[model samples]
Target: MARPVWSGTLTFGLVSLPVQMFTATDSHTVRFHQLQRGTSDRVRNKRVNERTGEEVPLDEVVKAFDDGDEYVLVEPEELDDIAPGRSRTLEITGFVDLRDVEPIFFDRTYFLGPKGKEYTKVYALLEKALGEAGAAGIATFVMRNHQYLVAVRAEAGLLTLHTLHWADEIRDPRREIDNLPGRTKVTDRELKMARQLVDTLRIDWKPEDFHDTYQERVTALIEAKRTGKSVEKAEPPAESTNVVDLMDALRASVDRAKKPSDQPSGHGGKKRANSGDTSPPTHIRDAAAKRRSGGGGRRKGGGAGSSKGASLDTLTKAELYRRATEASVPGRSSMNRGELVDALRGARQHRATS
Candidate 1:
């Protein structure tokens, strides 16, 4: 079992349970260290006085609040003295329906566990009650010198705490978004087709059915580079069909969804070929056929003419990136200009032989 990051008492009106909080999630992103080019020296960051150009010691640093014409310096000891005193307690104010809280307000989540063997019974009781009621407790607590408004609920047989954003922190989208679709007319036929398309595509919610292809590709690229193996650029994706008619597009979508597709749905990819879709209008059908016939050929976005012998040294980073995108080069997003050149060249060579 992993050790909890926080240990505190969770309290209601009169009941209190000794609980510990564990992180619910972790990021799987690839990380890199800064280094000087053409050398193995690691890059170092130093805090220095702006005017004197001298490195400053960590102990000498003091946080300051900026005013219009002056700055007010604050000491760590002073902040500690005035910080919220309920650091060891998570006091629940009230219980409310979980659905009443919007998802946008959620920031981070943590798993709440019983601190000791004696608290297990009480913890289970609270979890059961919350699960049955479909409610969560709203509470305020201080952690790491910062106060947070949070919701506590039961999930997956464990009590969970989710930090929520303050009301003033959430911005109204309407203020920034222009030309809102206040009212739009939709014909019965269009609505019916849209619903049919949704129904045809709907399936049981399965979290395991999806995987992060981009991250996988990135990992592959890193491994290949380390092993001194060749990298291949992927073919550019197809352009979506541009239809002016809403009803026609929905119908076509429904027909496309019904057919088996090679592209992964998890990555938002569509069918590569509509093998037997004939329900669409004659023009649409002709366009689909043309797309299928030219599937193996160069796409407009793929930079098709850049073959194996093409010189990548003279190309700009953006052009190299485009070629990498076409070839589905893994971890290409993070590669530097020189790395991209090397990867693109290797990809082209691999494609020529295969």
Candidate 2:
């Protein structure tokens, strides 16, 4: 069982409910240790005094604010003395519609559970009330000497507390960003094409359909190096679209989007066949044979097929990369535009011959 990070009494108006807060998320990122360049010795960091050149214990380290001419030192106990007294209490000052809160303000999340079985009824009642009202309780409390602005709301029959950033903490993008395209005008045709492209690429929001491909590649690279094998390098990013080619680019993108992807939807490729059926079905094998023998009818434009009159040279580098991926071309990632075109041409000729 997981332990609670905090135990406190949540209060709003005259009602008080005892609750325990548990962290709601965990990170699965891979971590690496620092080491010497040519040796296996681990490199570590230590707090040290500049004047004495000696390592200092954590308890002896004090925070110091640099003034123009002097340093103002503060002890850990001094900070504790100035912390708010409501450290063990989460008092909701007011409730507001959940939609009123911007996504940028929300930070970390914690699950709030009843402290004891006897408090379950009160907890459930509050959760139900919040859910029905579509509101979040605004609260402020201190934890580990830091005061946090938080929102408490009902989620899936339980109370969830989300830490929020102070209003001033959010940066004004208009002021901070220098290259924003403010008041840029677009032609009606361009806007229509852009909307068409968006519609063509529309997909349902399914978080499970996505994976950390970069992290997976990193793991693959590590394993490949461990086994004395070479790993494929990631392809270079495509060039930015020129303003003169904006319409053409949008049209091409829309056309590409309309075509079904040759790659798998999620991380991995096609599912493995069952043990009973080790080989592909008869129709699949016949289709493969037809493709290899060039007996299938000529595919239309924008397909990876090397049918008569299909021009691989006219396709963009990104398009060529896609075709290379579908054809399982070797060293496609590190190939340039011309090289990709040549490689695709070679692959097509080889397919036709074999």
Q: What would the per-residue lDDT of candidate 2 be over residues 1-354, giving only the tens digit for each residue?
A: 789998889999999999999999987677889999999999999998999989999988788999989999988778777766547889999999999999999999999999999999999999999999999999998888789999999999999999999999999999999999999999999999999977766665545444555666678778999999987665444455557667756766665444444455333432211111111122233344454567756456423333336478665555566666566666554455667789888988999999
Whole-model lDDT values for every prediction: 0.73, 0.75
Please give the lDDT score at residue 262 for candidate 1: 30
Q: Which portions of model 2 show Cα errors greater than 4 Å?
A: 261-354
Candidate 1, residue 136: how far the Cα is off, in Å: 0.5
- The lDDT of model 1 is 0.73
Error of 1 at 324 (Å): 24
Model 1 Cα lDDT, one tens digit per residue, 72-162? 9999777767756547889999999999999999999999999999999999999999999999999998887788999999898999999
| Candidate closest to the true structure, highest lDDT | 2
Residue pairs in collision within model 2:
none
Q: What residue pairs clash in candidate 1, if any at all?
A: 233-327, 234-326, 234-327, 234-328
